[model samples]
Target: MSNSQQQYPFYFKSTIILFGISLVCYALFVLSDILAPIAFSLVIAILLNPMVTKLQKRGVNKIVAISLAIGLAFLIVAGIIYFITNQIVNFGDNLPQLKLKFNENLANVQQWLNTHLNITIAKQQKLANEALNSSQALLGRTVGGALGILSLIFLIPIYVFLLLYYKTLIINFFHEVFAEENSAKVSEVLGATKAAIQSYMVGLLLEALVVAVLNSVALMIIGLDYAILIGVIGALLNMLPYIGGIIAIALPVILASVTKDGYSTQLAVVISYIVIQFVDNNFLVPFLVSSRVKINAFFSVLVVLLGGALWGISGMFLSIPFVAILKIIFDRLPEMKPWGKLLGDEVPTRHKGEIWQRKRLRQEASNPEKEKSL
Candidate 1:
């Protein structure tokens, strides 16, 4: 048998690989609740590592440094929640007036539909009733999602603390996994992974802050209520790759349409968000986040959609970092370098055949005598 066949029959190997991938995916889906917070905690721990190191360098105890780092992270998150909660309370107080206005608009729209398309109010009511029939299940889903978020809030901190406290042990265990001869390569991979993830987290935080500021300023100028709240929320949502950007734009536009008068304010809000996104994509991302992950847009979108399909919103948020980690590993292994290359945004090189053809063309161009002989 040829060497290729001796290694493994291509079809059999391909089937085994596919099966293994499927099994891994199913396991992830099954254990998502347990795994999600762990994944989140790992990212947070990595982010806080710099602060811990700085404190240790200053002669602070390791436990004290970790505690301080976690406390700081908690305060930042709590501040965001405080703003959001106050806005929500104010919004709740105005809900009755908003509902009254919404009913008036609905009546106007129903009348217009009747006049233009001869659709009766009765028919419209029936259609709405049909929609309301599914509201119970929708409400259940909403409650479940809220409960999941609550769990994350409670679980994530504990996980992060344990991970930070045991970080040295984890690093040593990782080193021990590889042969002593490969210690240098293992350490290199670990260092690169740490730097990439740390940079990624910092870049994302800076991007979100900038986006929130721009959004708040624009919305305030446009005379929108809760401008700060909406802007911050939108920025947080926009952290999710492909899907978040669309929702970020749509959300403010919807709120403006419902709460504000005329199309001008709505249009301005949309235009402002678009401009923010344009600048973010062209400038902020390239300068901050792009180098750290180096993932191609196509695969990023693909993983995001798959994540959403498999694990809902949490998956969407987690997918990119997981993919980046995988890419880091792939790049570190010689046999897996091609897979890493596939995930990257680097420009393609000419094939050997194309290179040979180009060389022949160049030679002919350089030598008229050789060309004539050919």
Candidate 2:
């Protein structure tokens, strides 16, 4: 076959592959309510597997080991929920006074704006009231979906338990998908994936703990109320990547402005968060999360945005691990190796000087008589 004829099939195959990916993405978006918990549970299941294996090696039964793993996971989650709930309740008790203080601050802001910008306080108040109403309506709609939240809370653990229980079968299914000759490669990939994901989970938890402690201590020193609660909430939200940090900074700073003495305290809170974010993005992530995931910053942000668009917050949280797993798969297959390179963090240094090198060699090859004379 001629070169063009041979290339036609390659182009057709590429188009088909692209179409397939698009279809899969659409299906995932449509089925997010079902898939989100399953995806989350899969990550938890992977994290818990090593513990289960250790228990089994110590003479524990598989069922007992699985139960212990699930129990530990549930307890950890429950403790966090209880602590946050208690803090929220305590904060609620002071809500009325906080509301009055907030109104005073708003009036001061409005008066300042009116004086400086010639904007009437009445107009500002009208806009504020409209915004408040819209926020309340949004909150009402969110609260109306409590059942879905409850279902996810209930189903996630159950899914984790079942997934852990049947992990061997899942592994077997994965192996069977490939040819017999590729079994060793398949096993290697599976092992690498487990190790990477487990390390990522552990690192993420440690990072959260470190961040929460730092934030709480900083806020406490600055005399911010509910320092621990705000710190912990911010730390947890920070797990969601770019968007989370902005929300984290806004939450405590807004509260500090109302509760604290002056704008100085609010500025301190903002500065503290900036420092925390700097430490996190520069140090903690590189040392902890990045070592495990190895995803480029560009692809990481893109995946998070796409996830949020398709499945909201849960998707954003899960997207990194999901893409990491995909990268692992792509790396193992020769046909997908280019994709693996694209997803990786490192730029290809070898390719930087390749074009000039090829041109020089091609010119030399065409000038054989001149080279011989020299």
Candidate 3:
């Protein structure tokens, strides 16, 4: 009967609602393998929507515009695959020489260890042999694997096409679902979400191009083998945020150690990667992606890890935009604005009046001598 007892019931109900939502999210993540292609398709649809709109405005039929957009996307994907396959084949052709270089480098490392450390040559050789055996097993399982390749060959394009075709319907459905009361708020959130995603994809693509070119040039200048392959792979991986940088760095260093015949070359490769990552993090990412997502470093890393765990690499690649979409939704909801603040980089200040007053006073303080001069 008491007010406090009534409040307790409300709090308990809210907790139950939150718990249900969390459970739903967990289930979705567990089913992510099936969902990943669909998620990627949605992302592609958002990216292509502007082009579709532009074509429509130019007197193209809606269906025709959608078809043209999808065709262009397919061509882009095909071209990338062709280029990557060619680079891979070229690398494969040079494998024999690369293997010889690797053995020579291993022998040199063993000799260096024998001279400097107290470990015996026989013990080092045993360890090397064990490592080789483990690596062979791994390659047999990974390269001989059929599941991943089949998914890429069959599933991806099918999903992408369906997504493009249904894009308008999906958007309209969401708009209608939320238009019961605050249609304007729903529209604003949807618009912001689309803009954020589009901006992110565009910026990320440009960043990758820049990184690929820089990495290729650096590796070529250093006279390392498979520089193009390393550069291109590095750039693509770099699209995944935090974890991608390390992978990009490691690939070059590993390849250099195995192909170039010296620790000095390996060291150089490492240094080059560090420099590239430095430029990318400090300059490229901030300039390109920071404004669009507007989430802080902590949430970025958290979402990426969660995404990786949920959908593997595909999830990681899509996580930021996913979170950005969620943030937009949360920001528009009165009770969920706190959740949005938690997801965002800048905490929304409730004391805006005080903040502005302080800023104005600081400006006045800086110009006191000017005021006196006037």
Report, for every candidate in turn, its global Cα lDDT versus the true structure: 0.84, 0.85, 0.81
- TM-scores, in order shown? 0.84, 0.85, 0.77
| Model 2 regions more than 4 Å off | 1-6, 9-18, 107-147, 349-367, 370-374
Q: Which stretches of candidate 1 lie over 4 Å from their true place?
A: 1-5, 103-151, 349-374
Best-fitting candidate, scored by lDDT: 2
Error of 2 at 361 (Å): 3.3
Candidate number that wins on lDDT, 2 or 3: 2
Predicted candidate 1 versus true structure: per-residue lDDT over 40-155, tens digit per residue? 88999999989998999999998999999999999999998898899889888988987888788789889999999999999999999977855443333222455457656787
The lDDT of model 2 is: 0.85
Model 1 residue 117 lDDT score: 99
Worst lDDT window (10 residues) for model 2? 137-146
lDDT of 2 by residue, 186-305 (tens): 998898888888877788888899999998999999899999999999999888777788989998888998898778988999999999999999999878774444888889889988
**Models ranked on TM-score:** 2, 1, 3
Best by TM-score: 2
Give the lDDT of residue 171 in candidate 1: 90
